[model samples]
Target: MNLLNCHQINELLSAYLENELDTTTTLTVANHLEKCLSCEKELKALTNVSNLVKTVIREADKTDLSLVARSNKINSLVKDEITSKIKATENLVLASSNDNSIKTSQNNIVKLNLRPKWSALSKKIFLSLAASVAIICLSLFTITYYATSTGPLLSGVARNHQFCSAIEISNIGWHKGYPKERLLQANNINLPKLDTLGVHFSDLHPCKVYKAPFLHMMYSKGDKQISLYYGSQEAVNKFQEKFKTITPNELYLHQESNLQIAAISTQKNNLWIVAGDLTKEEINAITSELAINSLSNTEESKLFH
Candidate 1:
């Protein structure tokens, strides 16, 4: 037969477990599994997941649903069909073990008879159950991932601004780490000079906003300080989604402690946040200016090139 890569083997694993592959392909997969540890581990994990889903389905049938008489009757019929299939599979495995004509390998691959073809109604029920399982799995994965990544970065940005603003008022100098120009160029962010808006750049330090790199630019207008934070689109999208109240380029307004904050995306979709001890109007103005200026710079660069 043919040599199958890990990805190919994975694609066949479900069918192989179901005794749906022809004998030659089944033997090939078995041989591959004996020699390949990664594919073997994957097969084991898939088996566990499959068994878990089956157990969940079985337990679901045991739930009391007497109030909904029609649904209860349907669940009863489905449970009976599933139980019969499980018993038939067990019997087939036992018969395979006892058959003298069947060949067995050292890796415990015993060929079994093909599964009996399902009736049309049986196929529909099985497919509907499979679809429900798939939907549940996808929803769980999305919720877990979103919860871990979003809803915290905005608070982190606000806290960073508050801490740094206090230090700036004390006349403390920021640590000069990476040069500002190189950082901006590497990240493809345009930090516009806000002299027109009375916000003058005071200092910039490279800092981590959660797990992503952020260019934290400090600005001053007399005694008032403003923070302009720029980071990647991926990081900012999560923060924006947490608020669930902004269009593509609209600003998200938030506050932490005494610091008022605003965030918006540039026309190029890069994220920018403006935060300070200012009113809603001031924070919104600074955020809009940064976004508009950054958008203009992007267009200008494209035109110049």
Candidate 2:
């Protein structure tokens, strides 16, 4: 009988030791081990290692409480040293004031002088100003760190021209292209022939018109259904205008599949198209059929560009 490899034996040893393998797999391993001397030796070594680990853990859990007490005593000594230093600083300030003329005059007279009052008030103001500066510095540092860390991720999402929006669709099944004739019958929108559109039947779905500034669509390709949108109408329109001179063939060559095919004349061009995941050929077909009637004037284009 052929012996199991070291890796295979290790797998069986782990499962057998953990008691995780089901009856059939366990029995298979056991039968192989009975005929394989090399596997039996590996299993024995693994068992010995597991036993040693358990023994070590049990001993570690029984550590003496005196060690913990000593650690706490060390921490207390460090805190007491810090408190003593602060008290010493306060005492030094009080002692230096006793030798000054301001303190001598206050001791000689019962009435409070305006000079001493002003000095005390000024000290308090200075301390308050210092604290405020520290807080502002800390806040700015934290903001800068967060912005630096997250900037790249945000830039990537923006570059992809991808955004998401929620739409209220009453029927999800209809959008998935299910019960096809029934859905078309109810909506009174004829199912555009799949071959005529040059797209597979599975790749299309009916989507509802949501609030603008966001364009929402529900479509399915094979088993996957996706809802996609652009972030803002202004951003979309700006991008479309930037690429106005770009022809369908040229855009296809550049593989700029994220842009949608525009279907409006220049004057009434409110909706900007945003594309998602379509191949170059598919994008070319769509844009050829849906090109804008007029390109933006050179003067207007220059303003945005």
User: Highest lDDT among the candidates is held by which one?
Assistant: 1
Which one is best on TM-score?
A: 1
The count of residue-pair clashes in candidate 2 stands at 1
- Shift of residue 44 alpha carbon in model 2, Å: 95
- Give the per-residue lDDT of model 2 (tens digit) for 57-145: 87786676676788899899989998998778556656655544333344563222325547888999999999999998886555433
- State each model's CA lDDT, in order: 0.65, 0.47
TM-score of 2: 0.23
Q: Could you tell me every candidate's TM-score relative to the true structure?
A: 0.37, 0.23
Per-residue alpha-carbon lDDT of candidate 1 for residues 1-305, written as tens digits (9 for 90 to 100): 68789899999999998999999999999999999999999999999999999999878876856648988889999999999998996777776776654656899776664444456679999999999999988875554334322235333433345422212111122244546787678777667778988889877765545444567788888888778777676656545455555443333445433555555556444666676667666765676677576756432111101
lDDT of 2: 0.47
* C-alpha RMSD by candidate, in order: 31.4, 29.1
In candidate 2, where is summed lDDT lowest over 10 consecutive residues?
296-305
